[model samples]
Target: MPAADAEVLIVGAGPVGLLLACFLGRTGIPTILLERRSSRGPGSKAIGITPTSLEVLAELGLVDRFLARGVQVRSAAVHADEDARPRPLARLELGGPGAAFPFILSLPQVDTEALLREALGRWPAVRLREGTEAVEVRQESSSVTVRARGPSGGETLLRAPLLAACDGAGSPMAGLLGLRRRVRRFPVAFRMGDYRDESGLGPVAHLYFTRLGSVESFPMPGGLRRWIVQATGAEEPEPSFEKVEAQVLARTGQRLDPGGRVWASAFRPERTELERFRAGRVVFCGDAAHTMPPIGGQGMNTGFADARLLARVLERCRRGGENLENLLALYEPYRRTGFRAAARRSRLFMGVGTLRAAAPRALRNLLVPVLTRPPLSRTLVGHFTMVNVPYSTLSGVLARERRLRLAGEGQADEASGG
Candidate 1:
């Protein structure tokens, strides 16, 4: 209704939103980032940052900050069945020889947000408004407007040329805009807790597929470790440390002390993807656009890739002589293509660890060892690190297609003597 307040308005100041804001802000773009929470929330949500994400951060010169504070997970050992002297079925090394970041950086989500927030402060063009929630959204041809309620119970209208909804899986903006999401909730649930690292495994991650269920142990910062156990569906959603400890011990034969626990929770994994990523001037980013099980650790990293691509699109549209329609038209299809590939990768990782039946479990045990060896292991690690996935913009895809089409035409011209 009124003149645009900023070039871009971002909903949800989570990791994805913050990073998106930083990316835009670095280019001196005017952005308004909104968050409903009054302050940073607690809990270690995502612990693994893929090499691709590190490269994205490296663009903003913040990778060193993350590398300084986060743990480097260089390898993960896969083991089958619990034994007194349990041996690994296979040990897969992360990051190839020519990789920019040779390992997955393990940092809690809170710290990651803090680092992004700190970087955002460097750009005065971007303003982050906390304790402000978007209640209504109106999109027109020229711009999008959002009616938000502040902490004092007052409504304010903020308009922007573009709106990026990085508000997370339960994004209210997606609902307000009537975006349709295809959601599939998995039957299996899991409980995880951060505890002191007593596994003597050092920086390596250990994944155990036992008769009971799957147990994953990963190294975290501050000499802490995170353990995730597949829940039996009877435990409470906010499971106690004792429950997690018992499951880990039964599955991996690793005795865990509840007293050493830092944080714990239980959740049923789900995959949700929007049918369309854009509606008018509004665009969905991060978990607001797609969500996958945390088992594979691609959810947030994929969102980072989304922000990277979206930033490039917005930057091009802002610089002039670019058809914004042509750019935005292929955004959803290209991102959905990448999201589906990443989702399949997540499902592949889940399948091996979550097998229950004797036949499937035995097959997985036999297959994992072979899969984690030499040439094939590089492919698996590439999937894990996301270095091999085509998590990029449609601009590149279109360019390649254009090249092929032109080449075909050139050949046809030569044949016809034109």
Candidate 2:
């Protein structure tokens, strides 16, 4: 294939890759997105899109359609105990008094991708090939030729000036590019699922912290809800509708299987982050760059935002230079700092949630509340929302807090509100 035929090739059509293609394609950048799977698999994971991600999607002009098919989550609450009534942890003013969409958006990852692909598919310049797996990726100074097993097992070669690996945690492109990552294990098993619960759980997201583990539930659209349980026994994989009954009984004190199950899977929370996000003409995106425990519910949302930011940076560089030297330098340090900071927090979160050790537990119960209070909590939530990310995330939080506090004779305004 000729070099002109290759502009940008993305391996992975998950939400991150689809988001990148949609954003870049909207700008008339020709891009090809490849997915190993031929179709969208059935399972509901990562439906929690924080307030900051919602803002990002809106800024990209893709939120309206997403919101049309998604639900809004207004608050998240964590209880001292599982059987304890849920208490509010963070109040998401997605549609702040003056904000556009101040609540968190809830939609299955499948729905999110479907809408993104549907939108991006409208653009003639964007092409998405399913049933295509990258057999090899050869990166040179000018371009990379990614050989894919096309439909019916024949090889399809794509030559692209830039290739971004959005290929999830076990990213094949990351392995091919010789990018080594550090993986830290989170010692716990979590059972997650999408189910229907008619019990009035109300507006807040719930996180119940017990010595055994943590279980959380968030209300979503389509009369759907999500529940995650912290498990201790050697149990079945992809937990069944019956398995959630004990948890539902424990949380609601009502009955068995109050909710009809939709999807279920067992996961171990672990953090995997690459030392560098970019190399030569290729770069990493989403889980290909960093993987974190799902505790903070930041995994998919963070990846999606990464795709949005990275695509813009890549597009800017594409306009200026054929060589991505400037782009790599600009993107690396920014992403490294982010992944490092996220890894640190994820480790702490996993350690706390699992609570296998006593010292860490004591330290956690004490530190978490302190960390979540006023300034600390606001900063953390800002990071979680990706509002303090890239540009104005923490800057705005600090700025707004300072302005409000400075105005008060004896009180900090954001502090008081927080």
Candidate 3:
């Protein structure tokens, strides 16, 4: 963003922005990227990637690096109670042709970003300027003017034919444009921490849907683990690590290490979608356009998908003036549909995982069996694993909405409908 001009000026240098840069670089498109952060932030967030996402990585020739560092979780385990035996949610029975590996993979968002940065290092056309933050953006008939500040007290400017705001959920570009994105904040708070421990917990991830609250753990690369425990949003932000561990133990009925903590933070599972993903010469991508709960982690993966589609759409347009009028059209339905769909699904998962209230927990415990029918757990587990995302096409969303409305009598039913 510090240059006087660029072909493509990307807003954020997070996973979405950098991966998009790598893709455009591979496809021989010149691009420049800017990020607000001086360096990678603490904490391991968004640690899951689906089969469809892996396929896209394969297309970028970056899957090998991810495959090298990530664990191929062919199966997942979800339990109704802490000590209750976990069950296989979904087995990777099918991956369409040209797909890269059929199963889901686990790699921290940071690790994914590192791999993308390395890939971008190979391309000379792609320039990355970290420690830079965008404060203003102005779009004209043929170009965009972006003003930014460096980590130090330095000012910079970038002029480009096109602009992409991948700056994340709190997108300045979207806000400045007066774009109102719908953000549905759940009345739930999850405290997540990463640690180093090789426990009896198997290779698969664990989800405990207990009456008190949910306690879950996910395995990361190099003997590291990511754990989450629900907290009542009403009480202060979150009690403390001691409180988090105590509740985690109470729910799972298992002893856990409190000293192995590497990173800890509390976050709400909220979903938001930009009202308009495009403007004159500026557009939005990834978290800038939409963000959802980190439950299934479709957040980063979905953003990566947006970057891929957007870059391709721009690449395919007639090569005359490169005004981005045609490419901007592809940004909406392709990305918004996925963002909206994933947000709705993650909200449903949040309800099931945390079971926020006693009444809702009882309602679910009683009704889930009736709805899922024979082998109820066996059938419903697939929904939690994100296996049904791509397989359940948009056309079926309306039908699924009606079915959910008739089953549960509340907002869960309504939100799932949208």
Top lDDT model: 1
Query: Against the true structure, candidate 3 has what lDDT?
Result: 0.73
Candidate 2 per-residue lDDT, tens place, 1-418, comes to: 4654547898999988988888788777888889999887788668877776777678678788888887777655555442344333333332334546656787888888888888886777888899999879997778888899987999977898888889999788888777788987755777776777665776557666655556777887888678777777754346655666676566544243544767778787778888778877778888998988877667777776667667766666667753456445556666666656665665655556566455665566566667666667666565545455542133333354567667784566567784
Each prediction's TM-score versus the true structure: 0.95, 0.83, 0.83
What are the RMSD figures for all models against the true structure? 2.2, 8.0, 8.1
Q: Note the Cα lDDT for every prediction shown.
A: 0.88, 0.71, 0.73
Which candidate order results from sorting by lDDT in descending order?
1, 3, 2
Q: lDDT of candidate 2 vs native?
A: 0.71
Q: Candidate 3's error at 29, in angstroms? A: 1.3
| Predicted candidate 3 versus true structure: per-residue lDDT over 167-230, tens digit per residue | 9887999887788988788777888777775566756777777767787777788887777888
**RMSD of model 2 against the true structure:** 8.0
